[model samples]
Target: MTDDDPISLPAHDWPEFPPGLVWLVGAGPGEPGLLTLQGLHALRAADVIVHDALVDGRILEWRRADTQLEYAGKRGGKPSARQRDISHRLIELSRDGQRVLRLKGGDPFVFGRGGEEAQTLVQAGVPIRVTPGISAGIGGLAYAGIPVTHRDVNQAVTFLTGHDQTGLTPAALDWPALARGSQVLVMYMAMKHLPKIADALLAAGRRPDEPLAIVSNATLPGMRVLETTLGTASHDAEAQSMEAPAIVCLGRVVLMRQAIDWMSQLQGNPPRNPDPLGGGARTTG
Candidate 1:
């Protein structure tokens, strides 16, 4: 493809992507450097890139001059392009013999609506590639100095969405089971209905004092981490004011922020040792 053509990596740097397929590549949580090697290769080879709102912009700047970039972000509580429309657009681009890359924030299948898009492409007889990235549930929390798993803390981790497609608390919500079962609960799109969700968790058996942490813009310069508890998640979210694309983690592991938080150390603000198992200091909001 010539320079005027959609973006593409040269024959040497990027491998050629099949023309008849769409690649679903996760952009990771925030840091552009966190992109997987395969993910970067696809971005460089793509003729057309349809990226979400949260996909790291720094990463997109790496696209070849021939690439075509389109915004298909579906932000919560905002007028969003229809999911069907986005899927069909991918199909159209591929049918035109263009290599399309659907770049999403975090893992595509991790509440990124990647499964729905893949289903649409499959039904239309289009081929696809799924490249995984670091999900915010884990990566985001990590940046805030929190660990989702520690032998001494949580033995299992459960990831869930804070809102359903209709923008409510995942109406078919099963709070009781989630509260009673998981050791660590990581939530996406949680900033919106955090209060209600936290309440439900408490009412369903989660200890009111259970530790919780919210990390916003994980791995990015503006990233902020709020350490709270199940009962205070909503209130602290309000007081400190977190926003969309943030990750919420709840469990004994939340208390680890003071112990093994490596990101802060990298930023030169390492958390003080607070004894994860002791401090009644539950972070919120």
Candidate 2:
């Protein structure tokens, strides 16, 4: 409601009378129910919603019939709207005096480039607002029964992208420190080059026997988690064949899945056999 203080509730509670401009809203992951009240409000009030492919369809139900909807998804290694073009479009929409809603998956600022869009709008002298949503790193992990942090395992968590456009790990990433630094690691858009990323972590001193859980289609009804050790995650994921729009988590906290495998059991699926080493499997790659 005030500067230096962000509204912490869901999208619905956001102040109705907003500044004349754009609002970058996160739609959470794939689940419609996960949408923040603020996100819901944006959907209803938006004159236009330029959204990504990752956003669920049902969330649009609350919108007025005349609201304009546009797509601007950027999947890894896929054709997407150019970032600059998208930014320019946002400016154009706002210049028309339309309340624009830039809907993104997960928290817009968390790897969603919401900040970049915000910067562009600000530089263009367009007013902008932000609303946070559930990040895949956390909500997605929960779908896989992998906790980001546990008092017994990790007190801290780290989030990173597994690779860059070249299909190689990001050189700018201080991997050596990150690999050795955080107690728990969560990676987004890492499936394509998971092997290289995993190897980097191993070389950087993380235990190969560490637990890894790859949650695909997180928070959706079809969400799947491949449990493995760091050394074998890539292979096992390949063996069973994992798909994208996934989240990968690593650390001892993953073991909690054993007691909390209720999602699987409810679906009549049983746990797989334990590895001979008494350690869980890794599946980042």
Candidate 3:
């Protein structure tokens, strides 16, 4: 096999990608290798792929040369296609006997609006297949050596979008409840309103010095992880020019990154701290 050739997988037990069916596949974080086997199969078999803004371009290289690629990504503060129109186009394409693939970043159901699209397809009597992918809230954090749930840290985790349809902080969220209820909070697209979110959490009794980590371009070559406190997250991100397409993790688990940053270990750089919890020093044999 050559470098340009598409990575192949065993076809055994794989479902056939028939015409007039829409497959909603998650592309995982930003790493092409993270694409699920089912997702890759859909990519190769689909006649057209309607992908989101976060789907990495490298993953598209696996699709057949003749497959049609459509952009229906919706980014904050940008001019983008309407959700209804995008769903309508999917129905139109499938009705035209094309194998339609809706590729989204992370799990489609996790703040990716895959549920809405699935509902639209079902209501329109369109056949569809759903493929779940690793969410950024979990997988992205893992890439940064931050676990969403830790036995010693958090027993519960909450995942929420930073904004609602109006492009503002979700007003319906009970800030006090979230502050006290969830042990760890994973926020998506929260960079735009980080300061406001921090203020709300602080007002709700969350500690100002609560540990937080912002992971940018997660699982990709340019991935960056910033460790800061809840009070300083907004200002620190701005001072460092942290960009979007990032994941924000808030809780004690953020401290665990100091001990288990395995990616750095691969390059002969040991973790900065071996005992993040301060239980005792861990010895390397």
Candidate 4:
């Protein structure tokens, strides 16, 4: 149990990573420690690494000295590589008998466009492996001390994106239905359209004073959490000059952050449980 050992599982028991296959791996939400053992193994064996914008650069250090690094990052309003081109590059690399690793930030299936790439690989008749990572919706919220679901607060949670292909608030989303059906909402890439999104939520009967928290640069050193109401979230975020790559969380669970912000607690602050929901009398599971 030395500190050098990252995992307790026996290394010899891990499965072999065959060549001429593309491995779609979730790099986790900005923390190197959060990367899975399978992901680390893939990095160590990958002949070519194709990474996204949100992935921390430190993770690339795990690759072999001869491993080729390729950037396929796509950021909002920034010039970047097209999705199709990246997919083609992956297929080409694997077809050349190279072990390709498509590394992404957070769970690849959760808004990471991993599905699109995987489909392309399948159509190309290339062997592929998928490794799940901790999505920002869950992992980022935890880092901010906001639970996605709590028995006393919400039994259900919904995850959505802030924008669609057209680069606007997703027109396909049924805002009113979402507002009525979901108890908690976790949105990705919503910062740019927060104003319109907030308006829709409010129009759909969501309270103006409903608690919400925006976690930016989640799990990294520069991470910032802005706690505000649905009504003021957009404006408040702008006032603070917050940037993108954030998770927008809305629900009563935001209150729990006051008492469970372990990151803050580590800095000498204590938990503050005001019991806004009046469920303090119940025992915690």
What lDDT score belongs to each candidate, Candidate 1 first?
Answer: 0.85, 0.83, 0.93, 0.92
Cand. 1 TM to true fold: 0.90
Count clashing pairs, candidate 3: 0
Alpha-carbon runs more than 4 Å astray in model 3: 1-6, 280-285
Q: Model 2 clash tally?
A: 13
| Cα lDDT tens digits for candidate 1, 196-252 | 888888889888888888888888999888888888788888899787668888888
The C-alpha TM-scores of every prediction are 0.90, 0.87, 0.96, 0.95
lDDT of 4 by residue, 60-121 (tens): 88777778999999999999899999999999999889989999999999999999999999
Candidate number with greatest TM-score? 3
Lowest lDDT 10-residue stretch of candidate 2: 1-10
Model 2, position 73: C-alpha lDDT score: 88
- Positional deviation of residue 72's Cα in model 4 after best superposition, in angstroms: 0.6
Arranged by TM-score, best first: 3, 4, 1, 2
Clashing pairs for predicted structure model 4, backbone only: none
Model 4 bad stretches (over 4 Å) = 1-9, 274-276
Question: Candidate 3, which ten residues in sequence have the lowest lDDT sum?
Answer: 1-10
Report the CA-based lDDT of candidate 4 relative to the real structure: 0.92
Model 2 bad stretches (over 4 Å) = 1-13, 17-19, 165-167, 265-285
Give the Å error, residue 142, model 4: 0.2
Better of 1 and 4 by lDDT: 4
* Alpha-carbon RMSD, each predicted model: 5.1, 6.9, 2.5, 2.8
Candidate 4 Cα deviation (angstroms), residue 233: 0.8
